[model samples]
Target: MREMTIGKNDAGQRLDKFLQKALPSLPPSLMHKYVRLKRIKCNGKRCQTSDRLTEGDVLSLYINDEFFQPVKEEEAFRRITPRLHILYEDDHILLCDKRPGMVVHEDDQGTLDTLINHIKAYLYEKGEWDPDKEQSFTPALCNRIDRYTGGIVMAAKTAEGLRVLNEKIRLHQVQKFYLCLVHGTPSPRQAVIQDTLLKDSKQNQVRVVKKNTPGARTASMSYKVLQSRGKLSLVECELFTGRTHQIRVQLSHRGWPLVGDTKYGTMERNRPYGMTHQALYSYKLHFSQEGDWGELSYLRGKTFQVEDVPFLPFFYNQPKN
Candidate 1:
């Protein structure tokens, strides 16, 4: 038998729904059976799964220990020394500042110490995650920035937070903005760049291709000049459609490749700062959705911006305000 108390954040939800979150590994049929068999109780009394829980409610589950076992074949990554620069955090979500050179997720590099691994270790140390107790739930990053682009990345602490964050991203409710330093001056000061981009998987690079070209996808972004000094110009770009390397390829095709982006940009301007990665940063994220966003409704109409850009001063005579 295990006793659990309902906290204020989880008080208003129904019993079954709360159980689904609390015991993620337990099957729904088994949960319903526990309620039907009176093995689950609230406030020292038998409670139905439909019962609405209030704050200070005491819940007891009289069950076997098999439910607490770790998931088979779902191995948890071992804890590492966490190195995260957290910008904001709440009960359900966390906003972290990712620096350059950190991989967002596991890929061809086999379990290289990544931001996700750091987040898991941090959460585990803080008691926000339980590998032995949780069946399938793992705290994960909701949004991914490229390995070398430093900026804000969203993370979810709970299952509901993760679900809602993904939903908002899918619907394009979460608006993103990036800042980059280009080598040459772009005409008209402000305009939208539209082009079709093709990705070369073998080379890990993207290029602008003709409209009728095979495997080409439409990519577009709007940019406004933030500041210009000498041969460099700082521009702010907002993506109309999210594509892999969309901003880099489209902007580079217009003859203003980002500084230190040797993949597309010329390496002539890559000096002075000895920069290894691009000077592009995902700087702002605005949450302006129309409808309800479930657990993240409080984020609507809000904008989060990060200002810890490492290469801003090197490109411009005066830093961008």
Candidate 2:
């Protein structure tokens, strides 16, 4: 028999959901059976599987000791040396500047040194996270950037933080700004590009298309030419709708291919710069004042930005304000 007390991080989860996370060895069928048999009780009383747990609630499990034993798995983060460029951090969240070539999560390549892993390692070393103590929750990234595109990625330190930030992002309450160097200056310095995009999963690419096309979705972004040097132009873009490679595909369709973007631009255009990956960076983030942020209320109306972008120095000696 074992008793567990719900903490703030573990609250608000359904009884069945909590059981599945707290006792991975227990089969789902058996768990339901146990609940029916009064083997599981909340506050010493029988509880339903759908009952939501709250902070300070206690759960008593009258089951086999074997089910409580922890599962053995490789914790790859332990072996990785944490390397992160922190832009902002608080008790509920963290903003990390992920560099190019770093995978945000594990991919087909079986890479171990990933951005999330580094975050875990960093938090573990700081004593903010312990996998053994957490039955279900782990530090998680709220958004993801491509492996080649460097940017500021948000990490949630708590379950409530993750839920709130995800909702804000979905509602377009969180604004994201990006910087990229393109081969040619945009004719109309500033404008919004709106079009439907169809993605080819097999090819891992996207293309602009007419509306109502099969599997096509709307994509939009507003961009401005910040500076012009020779034939290249520095552009700042804000995403109105996030599609797969939306900025790259939309701009390239309008004859303004991003520098070093071999997938969307001609080899001759990228060869002059001797570049491989696209010169794009998610440099700034702003949180809207409208909405209930829960524990993350402090982040409302706040803005965080990355000062140094890897490709920015090469284009201009002085930094852009």
Top lDDT hit: 2
Model 2 lDDT on a 0 to 1 scale: 0.91
What is the clash count for each candidate, in the order shown? 0, 0
Model number with the top TM-score: 2
Report lDDT (CA) for all predictions.
0.82, 0.91
lDDT for each residue of candidate 1 in 1-321, tens digit (9 for 90 to 100): 988777644566789988887776788999999999988899989899999888789988898777654345533356488889988888889888899888888878675578888888888889878665552356888888888988889998887788788888888888889999887778879998899888899998988888989998998789998888777888999987888888888888888888889898776767754778888998889987577888778888988988678787676564433
Per-residue CA lDDT of model 2 for 1-321, tens digit only, reads: 889999888898899998888888999999999999999999999999999999999989999999988778789999988999999999989999999999999988799999999999999999999997887788999998888999999999988888898899999999999999998889899998899999998898999998899989999899999998877899999998878888899999999998999889999988978878999999999999997988888998999999899998778843333
